[model samples]
Target: MGLESAVSLYDQSTRGRAGERRAPGAGARPLRPHAAGDRSVGFAEVRDFHVEVARRADPALALVPLLVGGDPSKRGKVIAASADLRSRGLVPGMGMVEALDRAAEARWVPTDMRRAREQSGLLRAAVRREVGAVEIEGLAGFYLCAPADREEALAVARRLEARVAEQMGLPLRVGVAPARFAASLVAEDAGRSGARVVVAEDFEQYLLAQPIDRLPGAGPKTAARLAELGATDIPSLRRLGLDRLEVLLGNHGRSLWLLACGQDPKPLRVRRHPTTLSREESFAGDERDPGELGAVLVRLSERLEQALQRDGLRAGRIALRLTYADERTVTRSHSFDAPVSAVRELAVAARALLDRIDLGPDSVRRAGLVLRGLEISGAEDRQLDLF
Candidate 1:
């Protein structure tokens, strides 16, 4: 996109962002990658996403240790720790008090779900305009299908990095690889280190050397299990032989092996048919009952499911939003194993997201569900995430 066009797009998408608050952190250098693209899949992750949203909106918060989450006085957990706080060893999921004890001078900022969603929507739209195919990883990350050839793919990525940083005021780390799993890992390191583009021919040698524990499904326990079996790295796992790995780790082993060798065939699901569906309810009064909130979510899910099916669509992502009596907003989302159009599946996912919120004894003044990252039914496919 041209500079004038990028500015125009930024203006249209970011009208309400003048009041955005941001946390402290220096941006990284732009990554320039040269590699052939053969069915290349790319990922872009916003560094310090929630905290950046806060910092950009509020200049005073810049260079401040900001915490995006519940009431620190009431002992809410830190959903997002700013880069400044993180540098001080404060991490997300730590209690607000603990975070403050770690960095007693930090600021507690209530999360603005509505603003975050708007920013995410704007970023997705921007990517869709420059690049044809895109997949949203919640509010902070994006998966893009690079152009078939390498040159155009790299150009799109360069423009994307500049566009996001220039237009959105959000720094992005771009990773282009043959497979999604590898692309995600690349994005993580690239976000902090620099941009990385791995060609199809180099993927196996590039990805397999990384430790086996870095993959999503290979958490602490899974990594330990693999370690016990002497399958500590992708290359070693491949050398361990797929048959034995399958017996030892089930589908997870199979998936990891495929990811390592760039054999996973999950397609880049683009948002060809765009639709944003949301359901919400305002309570008569503050309701604190978990069951009541869950019931509302079920009703919303039932309606959302019907809407998706009626249109022959499925939601690739689902977010649960809540408004507290104090007027604070919370939005938590979960990616589906696969895009889902079923009520049971959607509700189950929604309830699970609701569980992630720490209501404690707080009353919910309003609640809602937003379905985005949409795709036409059967338009693309994805492998299930192994636990």
Candidate 2:
């Protein structure tokens, strides 16, 4: 998908709104901008761009890109409410009550991180299946084209994007470069463009003039600090020298310094298989009821089962992570004597673990399920051992 196309889709809400909103268990309704033509960029475009840039720079250099799926607003209600609230100076990460007070007409719905992550997983699967090799960065995105030549590499990226559109109903924006920071910046730019390739040379020049806030790791607070120091853009910040940057930004400062210089030491490693398959959700409000939480867990386990089945994999171990109201976290896990793919079995194990934790009502914020000890079905014909 070209950048212009992606933006057009984002702007094209179901009924003319900024996005389509679907409440849990509610029928899909037309709200605003309707789904249009495929809005994703071609992976080939990204791969070629990265190859071209790498040839111009050091051939051994790698490209690491990042993407935030369902960013700005994870849901339609959230987007609508955020906009209504933002007009009155209310922003994200703010107290819900304060936001409502600011915009009495606003309507806000909680975020569904689980849905977002599932969407992300679909995209990631496409990347892995189509691309030559990939290294998943985190829950949301991954890195690609490791020391690959221009032609073969670009082909892989193009295939990846195509597969993602075919498998998932989400559009992807891609960037490519010899450096991770540069790749991320360019991908975002391309995502916003009507074109696919944002030429690496042009991307570098573009990076120099852009504000620090545009950089991957620079948050609002860090941007403010940089602004106070007379370093507004990447180029200006680059002149601050590593020692001075380390003093001001500490570890983050040093990392920023490297990125500003168009270098990232993070290497890409190919995984023959995923280390784990997990689903996590962060509630908009704290909940105390185990039943309610268990219901969510059931939903998550179902999703995980679908994911694993889609990939033809099974889990040999299960793990649960729960974060309480006090910001304290706990984790528990159990190994299965035999691989399991059934959602009921997974949920049963998960519920047992949940029962052991003390998550008072109004204090539990997030919960996650991670499946490890993966074994490819039929790859090994060992007898099932139930311990």
Per-residue lDDT of candidate 1, residues 211-247 (tens digit)? 8777767789878876766767776666655554554
Worst 10 residues of 2 by lDDT: 32-41
lDDT of 2 by residue, 280-336 (tens): 887888878889889989988998898887666889999999888888888989888
- Scored by lDDT, model 1 comes in at 0.74
When summed lDDT is taken over every stretch of 10 residues in candidate 1, the lowest stretch is 24-33
In model 1, how large is the Cα lDDT of residue 127? 64
Best by TM-score: 1
> What TM-score does candidate 1 get on C-alpha atoms?
0.63
